[model samples]
Target: MGDGPDLIGRRLREVRAWRGLSLRATAELAGLSASYLSRIERGERPVERRSTVEALAGALRVAPTELTGRPVAPHTPGESEGHAAVEDLRGALRDIELDAVTPESTGGLRTLPELRHDVDRAAAASFACDYRCLGAVLPDLLPRVWAHAGRIDGARTLLIECLFHAFYLAKDLGYRDVGWSIAGHLHRAAEATDDPAWVAIADYMRAEAMVGAHARTRALEAVVRSADALTPDAGPAGQAYGMLRLSAALQSAATGAVDVVPDYLAEAADISRHTGDGNFGGQHFGPRNVAVWRVAMAVEVGEIDRVPELAEAVDVEALPLGRRAWFLMDVGRGLAAQRGRETVAVDTLRQAEELAPQLVHANPFVRETVADLLRRARRDAGGRELRGIAYRMGMGA
Candidate 1:
């Protein structure tokens, strides 16, 4: 476990930030005191309990397999850099097997054996920050991961877990074809695994991809199915259900479900509040999760007065720099919309558009928001900068 605690801590921090949960909020939800969790993040303390590790993994929306080091299977022609980093990982696997028959074996040995072969090829792509690889590998990876689902190994669970996130990134990167492909694979994987959590997560991903494609009615139905699939018995499945509900509500509003807009936004906010900060194992919904979407919805429905308050409640400083910049620009959009300040909107949206490309795997909504704002400003400018962004997104003005 040399540097194991530190590596785990770093991964935990990255996941938390990616999901947009603050330390205090995550602490409250994970049922660990904030100070202790802080120490864990700082690598001053190692997570010693299986329950603790599992809880943290859940919050992170990762399987316990990832926390303990294991070699995930490869999905490429060349050996990946990530695999090279764990030169000893395969040796570690053999050692685990030898120690398994010994009474003096540590718990880490048991965990690794179960997780070793369940490696996610998508993890490799994500680690490399190669969206092109992600697009190429992840589309094929999900089926390969699920192919072993019926096998008596931990890989099945780990693969599906990784698949959830891989698909999400695909959707974010505007690779909806890959995203939907992964989602469809998950549908089969969940059926084989008998895990409603998997089914719900897959369904949610499907809905999200549909939204990205602008198939509003299909997205709503996918989300509704996700919500219906969530049961109290589902555990993490239930949490995933909540994710779909929020996504559905937000998308519904985005697509002109005017009557449901306020209630859906309110419900989404309430769900975010009730779920606390650490519920997803490190993947909980917070302001950065649903609230970000809600604020966008608010803008769509002309809830101008609430925008400032909502913006205030969010930890804007903690968000990824690019997103924080976008949020600030969004605030400016709301203000400009209400006051009809075309110049203000133009300036604010310009700042956001400049920062947009910096945001890797950005949600389509961000582009759409900027598009709408620029389009409005274009009316005043008689169509100049707005056309530029439209060209970038391959839209006609």
Candidate 2:
């Protein structure tokens, strides 16, 4: 469905970026040139030499095959009938002609003989995770995808998306490395797709993972780069809104760039409002969605004083349950700053802790921010009460 060259380029860029290597650095490490690598991403140059691909993949710590979206040729029967839909969808995702993805002419995008093998391998690894099998999945999936490097149309995008979700699922289930491994592939997929905006998005998410690792400076840089990459006409409104929200939140959290927070929030709000219910690419951001994210950003920027105003400015109660819980966490955090006494902090934090598990989905910043605050408060006060709260939230005693 998706073109092989485009898919390979995207995967290559994603892997290289995730490894944090500059084009020059990657070239030096892999014995390639920065200019040549750029040509590959732009799809002006082809990486047909397996030695070159293997070297690049090795440098990026990805298997060579993962860079190539087509691992093996599709079965004739699979290609002709039932697999038409899958192939078509894959083509659309690949955007084989460098134009916008459309419903028509999207089939037969994947012709890579190698990528097919890796897909089966990655899928098998993903399924093996059901048995709490991190070791099996990691070994089965990562290497194959990494080694089979090249463009195979929409397969690259789909594969990386699957990998990201798989890793996230593994992380939520308490396997951190699996999540990290999946996240590691985001950059390559974005690259092979030849979309700068998606590259920025992948970087932003990578930075988010770094934040969880407490790599604040790296996270901040990632967010700023993502924001910088925005070209106004990048894509649909919801995508832009999500990026804006992330940029502002990360800016505020990572650098104390508090002054920019309001502007960022306002920009995201404006986009959401104008977009008319966040319907971008068939996805909706809804009023509640924007408001909840805004609240979280406001809290992170120490704009706690503005929390009430923002809350009143939007309909918080009308949001999704996950979002409502997030808002409650924000409100709880904001209430912690009240002048009266430490009692308010304790009470508010308790609510935050109570609402935490739900907030963890789709919002990592809230969890990290709350955890850090609770840890600091406990250390500052040396109080059993604060320590107990952190323990209950699994922030680790």
**Whose TM-score is greatest here?**
1
TM-score of 1: 0.52
User: Candidate 1 has which clashing residue pairs, if any?
Assistant: 58-280, 58-281, 59-280, 59-281, 59-282, 59-283, 60-281, 60-282, 72-119, 197-237
**Top candidate by lDDT:** 1
Per residue, candidate 1 scores C-alpha lDDT tens digits across 1-397 of 3322154555667677877999888777666788988976775554433345556656666654455332222233332432332232223233433543232232222342434333445554453344444545443333344334444476566656656656545444444455566666556666667777666666766665553223656778777766775663324654665677776775666455667766655655565555544334223555465656555666655676787677667776566544455565566557555545545555655556555432311333333344444435545462566555544443344
Off by over 4 Å in 1: 1-148, 211-215, 232-238, 279-283, 318-397
- Residue 167 of model 2, lDDT score: 46
Off by over 4 Å in 2: 1-153, 166-181, 212-215, 234-238, 241-245, 279-287, 314-321, 336-397
lDDT of 2 by residue, 340-394 (tens): 4344556555554454332232223333333434434544553466556544434
**CA shift at 290, candidate 1, in angstroms?**
3.5
Where does candidate 1 have its weakest 10-residue lDDT segment? Answer: 101-110
Q: Give residue 32's error in model 1 in angstroms.
A: 53
lDDT of 1 at 18: 78
